[model samples]
Target: MPRAVAPRVRRAPAAAPARPAPPARSRRRLAPRFFRWAVTLTVWGLVAGFVALIFFAWDLPRPEDALAATRRPAITMVAANGALLSTSGDLYGETVRLRDLPPHVPAAFVAIEDRRFRDHMGLDVIGMIRAAVANVTAGRVVQGGSTLTQQLAKNLFLTPERSLRRKVQEALLALWLEARFTKDELLTIYLNRVYLGAGTFGIDAAARLYFGVPARRLTPGQAAVLAGLPKAPSRYNPRVNPSAAVDRAIEVLGAMVETGVLPAAAAMAEAERIHFPPAPSRDAGWFADWVRDGIGDHAPPTSDLLLRTTLDARLQAAVELRLEAMLASQGRAAGVSQGAVVAIEAASGAVRAMAGGRDYRRSPFNRATQARRQPGSAFKPFVFLAAIEAGVRPDDGVADGPINLGGWTPGNGNWRSRGEITVEDAFAHSVNTAAVRLMQRAGGARKVGAVAQRLGLPGPFPRDASIALGTAEVTLLDLVTAYAPFANGGRRVAPFGIAEMRAEGRPIAWLPPGPTPVITADAAEAMRRMMAATVARGTGRAAAVSGLAVAGKTGTTQDNRDAWFIGIAGGLVMGIWLGNDDATPMEGVAGGGLPARLFRDILETHRGRGA
Candidate 1:
């Protein structure tokens, strides 16, 4: 043991080479350096935050400006008789008060949209975290964290553009809104300004639009349905996707139960009873669409407009019904898949009724105003009119035999033409060869086209002889308008729809100017007499209504691709067209058949009104 101790002492004395001393920097304490760096980072972060706030707040919308923002004007279209036809653009109902609403209505929205709506200042921090976690877990945007106040801010002051800058502005606006109003006030504004589906805005409008009821009368189930619309409105629209809408409403009811807004039993009962009213029949949509499209020409874009349109609600309904019924019953047999109907008041040129297609839900092509198809023999009237102006009378004899002009040979529909016939008789029978000869006698097809253009038909009309036989394509609207002078005693009628327009209960200085004279009364009378012969004893016999004087022409294109009847009856000028969208030939569908019959049916319903 003594030897071991001496050896240890000697080894200690011999001490290992001293280890190198730590650097001066390493010797200093880490706490102060860490504090300095932390302070530096903190100051930079504060500066960045200040710059971000300034940049985002630079263009912040003022509260008053946002409150008084201009939105697309809401158009309320009424028939000539003041019956509600349709609404377009942003449809806002009466400004509803929170105190007046059914408690369940606001509660339903709160439960589904924001559970802590009452507690949150504007942004829901806890909800944002929860939504973040849920979204990450589900790998999609499974939840939304926006409070109702925030939503209101977005709808009021911001575009739907998704960007950090927009979100910051939305947040700032939401804070402003919250600070300026109470919870009830915020909710009231939200309900009055939110967008629902089908071009509706505000809870009241949505209520009336979806359920045909006022906001105060909303049932719990209906309230749930409306509450569900704030998220993915089109996807959950009852009119567009009822099943998805019902499911979403049920989810809303369940949320109400979870949020203590409704008892579980009551919520379940409400879910079971959550059936939507059948979507309001849009029978007048064609007419409404036309009026809406043309409204801009009459009135400047405003916040709210009430249009007293030229549409006759009763006539419009009957026209749509008759057209759809005819297409349903006889369309397949005639190989016809689509049809259009348009009726214009003779004196004012107001479009009283319009059915653009057999089923508007299926196809909305406004064949009456938009589609240009060969009018066929329908163009003969203009030819005859030109001939009459060229010193030819209705009784003048014209050759109806086969004729060759400039390498084009035109023939009658029967393929056997009478050698010679009076101009009136030839017109009634829609003899193609006779029309070409009349065009030649009337200074060629150019003269006939000029006559048509003078009568409100837009044209750089074909200058060839085939134009006399309606080889030129023309819209049913223009053709019908051209025929209006025959009924209105030679006055040219510019087609009009809006009878009056009011902005926010104030009448706008808008009225369609009166028509001007385009043709002589004698010429108009002669043309009427010829067309009267058509309805009385010729191809348009099917269009004759009992006790009503009717004048019209029948048109059948080559291979029967298009069948048309444009007529004047009961002080109205009407046009009908039946054809396939693909321009395929129909099964022997002549204008004298279904088209004339449809005209007769429509005229029968509105017999003495227009007259």
Candidate 2:
């Protein structure tokens, strides 16, 4: 015990090096207090900022004048040189009050956007925190967390940019808005000022754009879709992406059910009955969209506008009626999901009628002018025309059989290998091998592509052997316009939709006729004779009209991806294409099946009833 006590005392005697000098010790102590003071100043600075912001917002714009001078879009379309076809932009329907809206309308916005719309002063602190946590956990920008008032404020008086300044301004404006108006008044302004997709502004325009109905008549599902569009207008637009839009709408509907804004069973029913754009009535659906796209956007006018279009009202109506009826009857039987028809006057190149689909509202996809489809055998005409121009006669004999070009074998429809056949018969029968061989004799795809270009087929024509068979995709408008040479005796005419444009009351512009010579008379006559034979006794027999000389060709792609019938009737060039949007193979469909019948029906109406 004595030895241990001595050892312990000795160890304490060997003292550790005392920390450092007084200066270092005091410096270490000073840091923490300085940090505390700095934090306190930061807190005070934020409080000062909050006070300054409250004073700064005293001069903020009021809510009543928010929309007073706001620009409203108004674009008008006319057919037949000045008959009002449609009015699209700023398409404000009757004024809809929040009190009058189907309760689901306002509720949908609340469910998807701001559940605390009524309770919160403006910004939702709880929702913002929740969204922040969720976004942090998800490692992405998942939720916007912007309340309805915030969105309304941004839309009313701000640009769509993401920055701290913008966020601060949005919050300040939102607070001002809440202070100025009651919940219902704010919702009314929001519903009346929100921008939906497809160039639409306000719930009224959105309802008309998506469902062809008024805001007052919005279904629960439709209202949910409108609510979804505010998040991403172009992304979830039903017209652009139906499946995506539907998915977004389903999320909105779920939000509604969770928020007790809509019943589960009612939501289910509404979900089941979600027909986007709500079965469009007889309106210029796709053509109107096309016209609007052609000319620059027009501002809403104080007076009715007049736009002189190339569309023949009678023909347009008949084309739409027949196109819809055929889809309902013949098209369904033929397993067709979509169809487009473009009729143009051969001499003038004026677009007479355009039936882009069964319903424009259901699908505003303008297949006629927009879609670039493989013409298949329909492209054989260009080959034949090239051959004819290269001094090959319509009666010239060409071998027809299996054609193996660069390891790619092109097959005929019937597979009946006629060793040799007349050029006219080869074209009429749509002999693939013969067309390829003829294309070779006519200097390959280069000459054919040049001929196609001359006939108004704009191209970067592929050099592969498949181009001989029209494997390249081309818009129906281009194809139909190119076929005009065959109808107008070698003159090329571009398809035109606007005859004249008169804004307000004065004429802004007028389109005069422009026809250029593309091919020789002999070549045109020979091709016309051959095409006439196609309608007379070959694959296009179904397209023949009584008492009217019809010259057309039938096209059916490999695996039946596309069916097309393009022809000329009494100097009227028309084309019809039937297919699916996904380019899936059709069942038991040929150019001669539904397309030919539709062509014949339209032609008959034109000749008989003067449509």
Candidate 3:
């Protein structure tokens, strides 16, 4: 019994009753732990944000580098009449100051581009919110939130990319710019550096390019047009898309009314008065490109240049219109896809007008200067001229019948030869065999080549007898230049485009050397008479302009791959070439059919204007 009691007593003490924690104690314990967790989360969030900011700002461009950026040297081209023809490189007009601009000019841009420009510091939060709401409602992103300063920052120092990082950097750069520059100064830089369109890089250059006036002279309507360009430079370009530009300008005018910069009636008036000058003739672009390529030869390459060229704008327009009309009417039907034209002053050898193709946008290859093709019968003139130099008369008898020349027999265009004809008749009719005989009498192909070189045809002419039938390749420009001596009474003149090149208002001495005697005056007169006879009663009859002395040659290559008419009229030497770019045969097209008629039409259209 004692042993049992001792074992029972080993359960010694009874445990204390379990108790639940109070609500106040539980809350007090959780408060510190929750606070510590909150602190840790907040600190990590801040660190992440700082890392993101650094990631975006790491590659931000230096602000000072924006100011020191250099552009390619600008080339501004003007016609002989001082009218702007075209511009290449970075065409920035004279630096314009905001203070010098009309109040309405800046006001128009501010109203359309950034209504809150004066009220905010670059980052327009209200505008962003409003634009966001509007875009969300429209569902197609119909609104933009960028401030004018932000746009300037992106244009000056950033690539045009859309991403979160780019947006963040643009915002930072905008804020920095706003702090560093006054509002007016920022606007001045924007107006001076923002690209408008058509190779122009400023409001002033755009104004001159579009309206033929400076920025200071822009009307309200004109200013509205310029103000609309920043949205889409090429789309709203007044020169490229006038209707789109006008519609955009009308929107700008309406925005001006909304922003209280212009009254409703004034905006309506501006909409009604908005006018864009007719775009510059694309025909001039060919000549402009040629001058631009040769500009380095005349002026120092380091300076921006203004080239005053001898281009006759009126004649250029006429020639282009005629060529385009003719090609449009007949090119497709005849399988002709290309044409080129070159006109030069017969006395001074100045290129007055040039059209490399019917439509420059379709083909930019300068066919008149760059493409070298066989001149065909057009080369016969040089052969005949050589004969004249070697004591042959225009009336001298020559056999036009089929003849074999070193196993290569050449036949006339009609494939039927006139038995015995005067050398003038053989040349006028483009007789192939007679030209070969004349080449033989003129001491063969090499002798004729030397004569052509002296007369301005840059030639590494062939030595074969077939060279008499224009087997030699040459450019339309070279052929036209070689024909100039007859028009200018026998003086050799080198072809030139730039009359004067100026840098910083100082003229660079680039005058072409004076003309020299290349052929005897008597020989020149005889050739002129023979060429005139060819136009009057021979192969080039289609090239004649009524009551105007026109002399020219017709050239039709084998299979009609090329057709050409090189002529002189109104003291100008002009050349026309029609062909397919791949040298495919046309549909029975001959030089006498379309090319000669185009030459005649151009001459007639520009007859009385000193063309």
Candidate 4:
């Protein structure tokens, strides 16, 4: 009986219905878990899509009345309360309609850029996705997803920068353009708004630039050439690269033929008839360049502004005449090749006359505002001002003999010193030893440095023994700015060129008078008197004009590498410098000579001086 029970138990153990195979609940549990995960992921994706849609929809530029070329660039710099100074940047011709332009002109661009331009709405999503995929595969920007309308929108309202926000804006604008304008009208607007090479804008300007013909007169090959430029303006210029442009023209013609807008035979005929015009004149002066580049603070990149600067046309002409005459008379003999003059209204800090170089066409470097040369003794006015601030009289006594300071030796231009002299005498004669002793007595070189900074010496100013002898480098403009306080009885000056701004026949801005006081009236008057005495009977004597009392200082740098004269007239102050751009020494020329004469001429003739 025990054997039978054991056998039955052993067989029955496996037959417990295999526990019903756990009722197949493993897959059921997994199905619910997978469904929950799917639902959660779908919700998150929808939320993300909603957020993205809102982000792209908000803050779009208003498309109302934007159809006109209101955003066209026009920077015109007028003189201060006077005439036009200059005009720079892109210059556009009149806008043209598709009916006005030859059919091939727009046909060429459309065939090459977008074969289905007429079929798309504001956006061609399929084409854009295809282009995006192609660009991604290429790993560079080989293809552009932007339509012609998109490009027009970018030129009209956006900066030339690439980013996600900009791209979104570009897309929105493209949609606006597509919704508002017909295909032909859009092309017309694009023809007017695009920036072509060599500062030319619009299809009319481009046609004139590349073919010496109007937009309506462009031959098919010329049209193709201009069309190719939207991809790269300067690289495939027909005038610059004839063979390469012809090759690109061949491709454009093939596209035209494929799009059925042109027959291969006709396109080939145009390929042979293409002729490039001569390049237009790109001649510009330093002042024009400055106006173009320096109007950013007011106009900025988004606007096309008309700037009115504080330049006096009469003063500018006089300065040019005097500078040219002086250079022609004495340049070769004195071994001087270049010079600059900067004049500012004493009390107003308005830049009136600026001649940055002898020949701006040859070298566009602006010496008046950009070039930094050693001030030499021209820096002594600030030192003397510091002494005056420290309660030292203009007639105070100081040693003029040789002196040593911390292993550095400094000396005057002549290397010989008058034993003892009054501060006024030392300053007038430009005695280096006396100036150094006075700087030490006025509570060290740092005080002198402070005085220079206070008087508007935009620095890189050095505080050392050599500084007392005018060893620091400074721009002519800064020197003019520093000397303005003495002319205005202690008011600070920041030389400014912009006087007003306008845009599209409307007054947008006017510069207000700025008077920042940094010194006492007594100190400025005392310094002015001392400077007048120097011009009256000292090294700055050449700057003195008949029947006109002026205050001035002469500065001759080491080995005559830099010569400077800063003078203050009735209502204007000016600084003049003569030197080689390479800083090579002249044949013993001194600031008391040519520069002083230049100062005298400027002081006597400047219209703003009102003398």
Return the top candidate by lDDT. 3
Candidate 1 residue lDDT tens string, 9-61: 33345668888988777758776899999999999999999999999988888
lDDT of each prediction vs. the true structure?
Answer: 0.86, 0.83, 0.89, 0.79
Give the CA lDDT, 0 to 100, for residue 359 in model 2. Answer: 77
Model 2 per-residue lDDT tens digits across residues 477-550: 99999999888888988666777665545676555558999888888889999999999988999998887789
Ranking by lDDT: 3, 1, 2, 4
The deviation in Å at residue 254 for candidate 2 is: 45
Q: How close is candidate 3 to the true structure, as a TM-score?
A: 0.87
Name the runs in model 4 displaced over 4 angstroms: 1-72, 92-284, 415-418, 510-513, 605-611
The local distance difference test score of model 4 is 0.79
Residue 483 of model 3, lDDT score: 95
Compared with the true structure, the alpha-carbon lDDT of candidate 2 equals: 0.83
Best by TM-score: 3
Estimate, for each residue in 14-123, the C-alpha lDDT of model 3 and write its tens digit: 88887866779889999999999999999999999999989998998898997778778788989999888887788888889887888778888998999899889999
Two-way TM-score contest, 1 vs 4, winner = 1
- Model 3: residues with Cα > 4 Å off, grouped in runs: 1-50, 300-302, 330-333, 399-409, 413-420, 504-506, 608-611
lDDT of 4 by residue, 1-611 (tens): 56555344444445445455555679788889999999999999999987886796676666664545354475656666645445455756557888888898889888888766788885778778989999999998777777888888887867788789789888888887888888878888777867767667888867765666789998888888888887877777776787788888888888888988788899889888877654422222555665566555654455556677777766777788788788888866888888998888999888877888987768788888788778899999888888888888987788888788887767666645657777888888888878888888778878898889888886766767778878778989889988999999899977777777766556776555588989999998889888888899889899988877788888998889999899888688988999899998998789899999988776567644562
**TM-score of each prediction:** 0.76, 0.59, 0.87, 0.59
In model 2, how large is the Cα lDDT of residue 416? 91
Per-candidate count of clashing residue pairs (backbone under 3 Å): 0, 2, 0, 0
lDDT for 135 (candidate 3): 94
What's the residue-level lDDT of 611 in candidate 1?
28
